[model samples]
Each structure stands twice: as C-alpha cells, then as structure tokens.
Target: MTTDLLSLKARWADLRQQQPQSRIRDAAQQLGVSEAELLVTGLGETVTRLTGDFRELLKQVTSLGYVMALTRNDVLVHERKGVYEKVSFSNHVGLVLGPDIDLRLFMNRWQWGFAVQENGRKSLQFFDPQGQAVHKMYLTDRSDEIAYNRLVTRFQDSQQSTELAILPAAAKEIEKDDTDIDVSGFRHGWLDMKDTHEFFSLLRQYGVGRQQGLRLAPEGHAQLLSMEVLKRIFAEAADRQVSIMVFVSNPGCIQIHTGPVHKLATMGPWFNVLDPTFNLHLNETRVDQVWLTRKPTTDGIVTGLELFDKDGQNVALIFGERKPGKPELTSWRTLVDDITAAAIS
Candidate 1:
C-alpha cells in the first residue's frame, strides 16, 4: 500500500507547523519528493493544480497587472517587480517584454503549475518534469488581485485531484556524461560564431557541454577568472555608473537585467545586488569557475564573463551593455579589463 497525497499533505502540514520559516523547496528536499509533488499534495486546499491550459495561463497572466517575476537556478536567484506585457510566443519559445520584467521562456519544459497560497502569500509556480521550479509570479499589493482570482477560477482543474505525474529526478545532481565529443568541430564552431546566440547551436552540434567547451576552447578565446573578481566587477560598475547586462538562467528561462547596479553587498556566502526594483542573490560558495570568453561578432569581438557551477551548469553571464547596431561600450570593456588586470595583479 502506498501513502496517498492527502495523508502525505497532512504530514507535511504538521512538519511545516514545526518549522514555520522553512521554504517549500527546502521542505520538499527534506521529504525526498519533487517540489511539484509536495505542492500538489495540498490540492483542493491552499493549492489548485492549473488545468491543461498552463501555457495559456502563462500568456493570460499579463492581465493580472503588476506582479513580481522570479527565475533562479541552484546558485543564483533573480527577482524583478513589474508587469508581464508585450507577451508573444511562437511554437516553443515565449517572451515577456515589459521594461521591468523581461524573460526568454522555453515553453516545452513547463510541466506542472499550481496557483498556491500559504499564510496569505499567494503565487503561481511552474516546474519542470524533474520537479525543479522554472519560474514563479507573485501578486503584489499593487497587483490586480481581482484579475488573479478570475484567472484561478478560469484555469482551475475540473477534477481538483492531487495526484500528479512527476518524473524521477536525476540520480546525479550534475550530469557528467560526456563522450565522443567533437573538440575540433566545437573549436571551429566557436571561432566561426558570428553571434552569441549561435553558441547554443555549436554546443548541440558538437555534443559538448558549456564548461567542457570552454575548457577545450582554442587558446586566446577563454580564460578562467578568479572568484574575487566578481565582487570587484559589481563595485566598479557601481562606482563608475557603467550600465551592464546581467543574465541569469535556469533550464526553462533566462532573465536579463540591464542597467547600473548599486549596493553590491556580501552577506556570508551570498553575493547580493540590493537594488530597489531588481534583486540577485548568488551563492558565492557554489561558483567553482568563472570564464572570460571572447567571441567574434559582426560588430567586433565581444567579451562575456560567464560563471559556472561544479557540474558545468552556467550560473550567470555578464557582458558590457551593447545594442545590435552599436559596438560594446568602452566603460564596460574597461571595467572587464580592470577586473582581468586585478586578477593577475
């Protein structure tokens, strides 16, 4: 006999009462269950599984007005407060193009969704098949709670069942299955790249991972940076008032913040950007390697600072602010140069 979701939820409810401050992700980890599995356990109560129209729900969510959009990986968490507007989608990819909340979404990985409430805090959380959160949107006091209520009512599942078909999580925290990699082809692809977007195709074509490709990149193309350089970059950007681009992504979505960042502070093992509208919390300890990579583009040779975890997954990417027609900003390039120089000094 297997334990039902109701029984499991009752136990979870009890555990939550014991430790009120614990987050759902941490609680799910403690229970040896996917976050989605733990979340659905509260179906018909504080949580309602969104119906088959999860994709449509994401599109329609823009009508809810002001909301806080959150996207994070294991090492970095990014939260932006704004409205979801100018929303458009193709077959597989979607975009939320508002000034404050901008995201490039990979729609295929969106597996499960729930409109959830706990202790008066309400949010809509979406997860991948492996039970990791892809993105979350929380309603704010300024947000249209009325529209939120309407959307929930419209998308609420008819069955109101708690059972969810969750896929088994990966055995290893990081995938290291690299074999038959075409190093030469990958190098050629790198040297031949005309735009940064083509890099993903290069990785897929050669079946090479991001870190592995960096490790095997042609000489003069990539250099591993020191961990200390990150703090310096943030502080210098603040002091110089240099507008830069920060890209943080998970498997499902990439969130971008472009502008000057002030109030770069470190609290224990975390590196935080304490800006008013944008917040980025990065686990400094998990950053094993930082790479300064250069790629040739039509504008010129563009440079990027890419941070990766121990498992070769990208934590974040930083680049000088530049538009399509213009070359990279000299201030941003000078900042990177200063950081690179400090690393050697």
Candidate 2:
C-alpha cells in the first residue's frame, strides 16, 4: 500500500474504534471522503473489487436467488426481498421487472462494484463515479451462497489495490426566475401529457426543476401539503387497503414497490412501511416540501404525493398503482382528495 493509503486506512480504523456503531456511509461522511474510497481500504480482506461488464455481471444475479435489494438516497431507504428476473437493458437504461425487486437503473452512472462480506453477511455493492452507493444486494438466509461465491470468483479484479479514483460531482445549474419561464406554454405542455413517463421529458423541455414545475402547475393540478399529512396518508392507505406505488431513487437507480403498504409506524424521525416482502424507511424530518400533484396520463389523470428535502432533492413519490391502459383508481383518487380536503379544512 502507498503511504497515503496506509495513513488513510489507519485513520479509518481509528475512527471506527472511536465510533464503533457508526455505519460506513456515515463514517466516510465524517472523514470527508466517499464511501467507496473508505471501503476500498478493506480490499482483499473483507471486500473484493469486481471489474468487468457490470451489465453482464448483473444478468448473472439471478443465480443468487432471493436476495434483499436495497436502494437509498439521502433521506430514504427502500428494501425489497426477491429474485432478480426479467432483467433487460436498452442503451444506458436498464430495468429489473422482477415481481418484488423492481428497479429502474441508469447504467452509465455505475462505475464501481464490490463483493463485500461484513459481520458474516455478504452483499454486492455498486457505486457511482463519485463513490456514492447506487444500489446494493444482500444475501438472505435463502440466498444461494454457492452461486454468489462462484459469480464473485469469476469477476474479481486482478488488481486488489486499496485506492479509488474519485470523481467530483457536477456543478448545479441555477434555475431561471419564474418570470423567465414560459409559464403559459409549460402549463399547456403539462396538461397535454399522454403518459406519466412523458412528465420527465416535459420538465427537460421547459428547463424546470420538479418543485418549480409543481409551483407552475395548471389550476387544481398541484396543492401544497404539510409534512404531517404523510402520516395520515400512510394510515389511510393501510386502513382503507389502497394499493400504491412507492418510488425512491438516487442518481443511479430508482427502486419501486407497487402494492399495498401495511403495518405503518413512526419512531423518532422515521416513517416506515414494515411489509413482509418490501420495506421503506423515510426521514420525515428531512422533508422540506410536500406537494400533491396531478398529471395527465393516457388512461386518465394521475395523482401522487411528492416529497422533497431542503435541498430540493426528491425524498420519495407515492402514487396509486396502475398499469398502462388502466385509468387511475377511483378509490385512490378519492383517498387523496379526502385527505387533502381534510387537511385543508
């Protein structure tokens, strides 16, 4: 190891000794380094760097059946237990249409991967160029350990260096003033949407940030709500049996759950969905803005609750579960309408 890396590893060890319970992600933050950078210090010990076509490696994940897929951003973590099936890629985007482990992957953002074994638990971790984790899969008791071992052995990088090349994050673009935007044209475009997927293209076309777009939404299409409404929404969804889609993403991946959420709880800053196959833990305190948004879809109008953190980063998105050619669920629409009405009243 180089002198710098040796020093870094020593410092990391000392930090761990001081804060034994701190997660690696938090510890890396405390040391002002990326998680992948710190994580590499354990190379050839508990972690193995894997270098190859990640897409090809991902296709083999099915062999390690029934693992726990985890994806998270700054304020929310989404976990689901399932086998990886129906994996497909088109250009830089990939999709895992598995019944339980559904994900939308931005493959181009993925830069590093590792096979990790910590505290007797094994996992495959993937990270962005900035060393931030994009997605992870942990082995459950039911996972095929032999398959995982074989796959890791096949792709382990020959170079086991404890050094990582970190990329600086791109600069943020300053949003234009409201007066500078074509509000009339933007509203028209919002109202003219034919599919929910088109909303993203519409945003790019208008150079509008998500919250900014919400602010400019056509009449009755967007309503500002309070944070407390999140609790009510969960309670109502559970009590009334409303199946919904929960979407949580980082820059690299979007993990989705499309079904009913039950056994909701709030402990400290977290609001949780403790379902059997899927789970979500959200930092309620991190939410700086909550908006009820309605969008035009081919089947009909679609409604959802959007949450954002103080930095205008999306915390999560909750929408009624619906498939193409199917209109928005009347029950879901009524549930949201009633919640909004009650909150406002």
After superposing candidate 2 on the true structure, give the runs of residues whose Cα lies further than 4 Å from its correct spot.
none
List, residue by residue over 1-345, the lDDT tens digit for candidate 1. 137766678778888899987778878878878888888777777898787756678788888888888999878899888889888888779898888888999988898778999788789989998889999999988888888999988987788776667777566443245556767777888898888888888877877778877888888889988778877888898999999888899889999888888888889988999997788998888888999998878787788899998787787998888878678888888888888887888
- lDDT of each residue in 9-123, candidate 2, tens digit only: 8998999899998888878888899999988988879999999889999999999999999999878899999999999999889999988999999999899999999999999
Q: What TM-score does each of the candidates earn?
A: 0.91, 0.97
* lDDT of predicted model 2: 0.91
On lDDT, the leading prediction is 2
Evaluated with TM-score, which candidate comes out highest?
2
129 Cα displacement, candidate 1 (Å):
1.2
RMSD of each: 2.7, 1.3
Worst 10 residues of 1 by lDDT: 169-178
